[model samples]
Target: MPEVKRKYVTPGELVGKGRYNRTSNVYQIEDKFYSTRVGMAEVINDSLRVIPLTGPYIPREDDLVVGKIIDHSAFAWEVDINSCFSSFLLAQSVFGRDYSPARDSLTKKFAIGDLVTAKILAFDRTRDPLLSVSGPGLGRINQGEIVSISPTKVPRVIGKKGAMIKTIENYSKCRLTVGQNGLVMISGNPEGIILAKSALDLINHEAHTADLTQKVQDLLSGSNNGEKE
Candidate 1:
């Protein structure tokens, strides 16, 4: 396998010249791939994707997201997933098939201002995304401090094969639940949480850097009692 390299790219720039097994944020013309926006172009193995430096989180099916309950209707609760489009969590999803608006109050399960970690059940260009909290580690975020970064930086935050997150969690003694939509829930001691947030900030600003994982490890390992410098 060839070594993967990430490069800054601009709109209409030629990203690659090959058949890719997967692609994102780039259009292909024949055997060439052209970037669709200003961002970082990455080619790993047979996959090619341009991680846009600036953009809203586009909803994709099965994306884990942390969202805020902004409003509620009779049928569903509206959640702000930090995207241009709001998402819906139906009452039936939480209350079973026989749920009733009068008998089963939506607010009872999730109220305004509550944060939840959910999965994008379904989404298409035609309708608002649907959410489900019916899985392991998915539901109202009752604890932890929330930290948000650019959605595009999520892949970098997770690192290659979970190295970055593992480093932070192991060194800082914090558990990080990162959302594809850019929201992060850091749960641990106060000091550990502070250190974790600092690491996340560093990753967000320096995602394009090649040695970011090492930098984050240094940041975590060098912190004294998890105090911010």
Candidate 2:
């Protein structure tokens, strides 16, 4: 009856089932003839993109993430970026040098519990994605603890690119990276980090909600108001 933005569509049925009308980026409900976006829904005939409520974190291309230094070695530091598998950050990829030769690395710059801000360089069907901290204004993180969430929910936090994150940053008085693969790194005063993490968790939980922007605004407003009183 009414046309809406493309993002509003939900999953329809399994893919390749030879059912449902294909239109634009969505499949339509044969009965209602309503078009919907493709993802995380049944396609009737084709396999759907619907994921379980919870699944292993999968990394996609160009995901910005917060990396937690878990273990260190002579060559690279091991980081858990909330991916299906943890990733490695080579010393060369980062500005600070543990050393040179590529054989003996210095892990002192990063250690267990320290969080680093980085971006995914490459992700393939197999093997872990390579990450980098070499981008402009990007490098080893200075402070704060990393917060993790469902990879799918990352979009909600980032908000149609970077708009959503900018709001959270302004509201919480914290700096953060909403990673492509759902890895979030929060840095600021300890209190700010905690507040940022709380906001992140709520966004992840309510990703499918309508009026997401409004919901987040309300959440932040309530929190700030509570602090003042």
Candidate 3:
């Protein structure tokens, strides 16, 4: 995907000239498209549109997301996706039509304050994003330290599979969970989690390095020996 730089649209500025409502992205301006509100401009091929910096997260289909369970019922759980509206995961949506597991089990199907990883199945543009938990590798989180950072750095954290993630895992001997929106959860023994979290943070701060391998190795060794913070 080509990168789009975010800019600002001045008040009363007509960046989009389209006659219809274009996508919310600030980069594209067409006929009937004009600034609906004052906010950041998503630069699109020499044009700009407006969108508020603080807005509801509108989930697109297949978008991997991190959500918090705020409400629960015997049949479903409602998640606050850090968006304008909350989402819901029906029991069937999580376990599937035929998959069966005792609800009373301590597997943490979901409970208030529990964080979960899931795929956005659909966005009811009319409502909150619809998320699903039935897909492979989708389920409750186990053992991890949740760290926070700027959402823009997600792509850097998850370099090509995971070549970046793999490096962290190998060095820290821990598993890391990086939410696309910049919510990271690192899990392992206390020492391992700390090492993994710090290493990942290093990667974020120093992504410009062309030779990352040696630096990663050195960091791992230092972390293991408790050489420095």
lDDT of 2 by residue, 188-214 (tens): 887777767777877877777669788
Task: Name the best candidate (by TM-score).
Answer: 1
- TM-score rank order: 1, 2, 3
| TM-score between candidate 3 and the true structure | 0.63
Tens-place lDDT digits, model 3, residues 69-166: 88877667888666566788777776667644564432356768888888887776676677787766566776577886555456567878678778
Give me the runs in candidate 1 sitting further than 4 Å from their true place. Answer: 3-6, 17-21, 29-32, 43-47, 223-229
lDDT of each: 0.92, 0.66, 0.66
Greater TM-score among 2 and 3 belongs to 2
Is 2 or 3 the stronger prediction by lDDT? Answer: 3
Structure candidate 1, residue pairs in collision: none
- Alpha-carbon RMSD, each predicted model: 2.6, 6.3, 6.3
Candidate 1 per-residue lDDT over residues 1-229, each given as its tens digit: 6879789999999999978999999998999999999998999999999989877899999999999999999999999999999999998998999998889889889999999999999999999999999999999999999999999899888988988899989988999999999999999999999989989999998888878877888788884445554
Residues forming the 10-long window of minimal summed lDDT in candidate 1: 220-229
Total backbone collisions for each predicted model: 0, 21, 13
- Name the best candidate (by lDDT): 1
